[model samples]
Target: MIGPTMTPEILARITAARAARDLSDLARQAVGTTAETISPAERIKRARRMRQMVNAYLDTVVVAEALAGADWSEITEALGRREPDTVEGEYADAVAEWSDAAEAEADAAADVEELDAWYARHREDHDPDLEKPVADLLNRH
Candidate 1:
């Protein structure tokens, strides 16, 4: 219980599959969008950004879920691999690594929030006029 519930091999497969699916979806969307609306270069850039965002979100969710609680036996059974005990060590190591990473990400997010709050407090010095437009664009998304 100290580490992740799924073995590293299983986790890797799941992660790869998810990433592939996300990238494929992004590619499909990019292909579907009108080239006149957005240039091919911009579309590629946006697709990369979208993929990164998706992966980041997925990482957070997976880490959180692992930390909350996962049934190792069930996962192992689903994977049709070794017994739970056989992969417990690998799972624990993966969990510990992810926990540390999650903590670091949380700290970084807090720092970003702090900086954003500071910028908000001193909006005049920062591009106060563009704030509305930026907010509008973000909201539209």
Candidate 2:
């Protein structure tokens, strides 16, 4: 994640924006349909599910942008100026680090439908959520 943008206010804003987007989607989906028949509980559950999905998706985009927006020198350094080490040992250490981080993420993300909500907070989705180069890099994959 881009360090400074992660905050409680940002996360709350994201949740609000997701509600806006989901309502916008629901309005479209409800056209000439029986969506009005859904119970309030079901509607809330659906929104929660949608928020979780969007949060996970935006988290992925942020990570991708963090990579694509970086120069090679920065990327290499961020990966930890590699020293000679066993791939297995490095992999094990990385897993341990990620596991700890994942646990923290899980604590933040009580909304995720399943495991691996690596980062929380859905995005507000203003156009150009990511930079042009970053978007292009992601689109390629």
Clashing pairs in 2: none
Model 2 error, position 81 (Å): 26
Per-residue CA lDDT of candidate 2, range 48-98, in tens?
A: 866676655444333333323434344335555553233224334433443
Candidate 1 weakest ten by summed lDDT: 132-141
Locate the minimum summed-lDDT window of 10 residues in model 2: 111-120
lDDT of each: 0.50, 0.40
The TM-score between candidate 1 and the true structure equals 0.34
